[model samples]
Target: MFSVIMYHHINSDDLPLSNSDTMMDAHLAYISDHFTTLFPGDPITPGSICLTFDDAYYDFYHYVFPLLKKYNLKAILAVPSAYILEDTEIAPEQRLSLKHHEIYDGDNYKTYAPFCTYTELREMIQSTHVVIASHSMHHVNLSEDSVDLEQEIFGSKVVLEEKLGYRIESFVLPYGKYNNAAVALAREHYSYVFRIGNALNPSWEGIGGLIYRVKGDGLKTADELFNPFKQMGYWFKTMIKMLKGSR
Candidate 1:
């Protein structure tokens, strides 16, 4: 069985969407020693783990990325199409104060940028340890009936590919919220669709194009991440979700 762990910022501030550098070191050390880490295009071999970071925060490039390299682990960094700046002179520290939601304001760019810049992303993509995934344009909630599927779904793919100079193979729902229409459109463009369902993706069989993910951001230690009881909860919920036909 395989599991996909969702993460956000890797900063010293310890915000809700972040993990400190120390905690991140612990996570990578333990995960590297224990399980085989996989990425989107890799085979879903048994016992493989997919370590994915969302929003492509600047701290990820500054902090978590080095840990990933030191540990020799692979990770998928999800980037929202619009938030990524073309280039920036702002200090990464100044940018760190900005959070995901606040990035929507165009006025915010005058000061600092929160998300990864195209320059930074290009550097990471050249490395063997990272792969890019689209997090949609503007990070909007795609389940909304008023949302434009072209811009939020396929349009994001086009933008990222143009900016990063490669095809993006995966789509991660901005808030892990989606409906049939959203999922259907994502399937048309991506090989994988990552969403929060807290279930173990034991295999790709009958999985459609969807790859379910569980929250691992709150975990302080790898022991807590794979606690037997918690793993049982995953198994139990996996059964329930499969039985109920839930995604």
Candidate 2:
């Protein structure tokens, strides 16, 4: 089955929501070992591998881009258009501090740290290997904020298309939280929707599972990427853990 690997940060230090470089290398190595790397338009087969990252973080530009070039792989990056427009560059120290601390919270949503700037995003796009997508206006939780839901979902598409100068067809629901209304809203714009969790195949419950993914952290070694057994073990365990948590 086709498997999309979801990743976040690729920074040197381990941020709270980060995957260490060691883990990232091992994950990619495993792909090279067990499956052939496939592009967006490539024919799909069982065990096909596609890479994706949510929230255009600075580490992706700083760390992940080089690896992508080295391996000659293609991947997608989903970004918060408004945040990128602000052009905020997060330093390692600032990132660590936010991860360790709670920056803000309202209703049940929380904000942690700053993300990458539009400049960095433009730089990433310069690499022919990377494609940009939308994550929403402010990374807002669409499942609960029904009043602003229209703006959050549709507005993001407009912003991203304008900023990146391309039509964005993919999206990752922030926190993997959504309801019927949100889904209905998303269907109007996005062709593929990604949820956060570990599974070989994404949920086919609706338009949600068109793209399935397993999280890959950079903390593991590059060798792990090439080891099918190790990657499978991690994938299975992660899926089980997420299933149990959902229940």
Candidate 3:
């Protein structure tokens, strides 16, 4: 089965505002011992799990990347092509303090860019431990009719490929919001499309190229993930989402 765990910010100061480094390290350790960690394009088995970090936050470069190296594991780093800068002059702590949407605020881009820079991303990719996926161009909601499906779906693939020098085969719907038009257009451009749903998939094939990811950001510890109750909870949530038919 294919199961994906998604994360966002991993604060350096052990702050749980989103997720702390210590807990993430523990999670990496547990995953290394238990599941066979796979990159996006790799072949999978029953115990396979894909670890994905969304937004390519600075904390990821500072904290989680090292933990990934320590565990010798591979992961996907989802990047919003518009929010990313070539480089940032701000400190990691300062950038980590602001809300993700703050980057769009006037002159905030000059002060501090919240997302990772292309330089940083390139460095991570050099290690062969990371794969980049498009999280859309502006990270906007695709359900809105005013939004441009070409720019949000295919355009992001173009930008990331030009900047990062890699063929981006995956599209992670921003905010997990997408209409059928968005999905249909995405399938036309990319081989894999991802969204938020805590479930297990049989494999990457026969799923119409759509994959579901679980929330790994709110986890408190490795135990919380491995707990039997939590395991059942994931399945139950997945079933509920399946019933609702992906709004």
What TM-score does prediction 1 earn? 0.93
RMSD (CA, Å), candidate 1 to true, equals 1.9
- Model 3, clash count? 0
RMSD of each: 1.9, 5.5, 2.7
**Clash totals for all candidate models:** 0, 22, 0
How are the candidates ranked when ordered by lDDT, highest leading? Answer: 1, 3, 2
Query: Number of clashes in model 1?
Result: 0
**Which is better, 2 or 3, measured by lDDT?**
3
In candidate 2, position 222 carries an lDDT of: 49
Model 1 over residues 48-91: C-alpha lDDT tens digits? 89988988878888898888889999999998887788989998
**TM, every model:** 0.93, 0.74, 0.89
Score each candidate by Cα lDDT: 0.82, 0.65, 0.79
| Model 1 segments more than 4 A misplaced | 12-14, 99-101, 205-208
Model 1 poorest ten-residue lDDT run: 201-210
- Winner on TM-score between 1 and 2 is 1
TM-score of 3: 0.89
Best by lDDT: 1
Candidate 2's C-alpha lDDT? 0.65
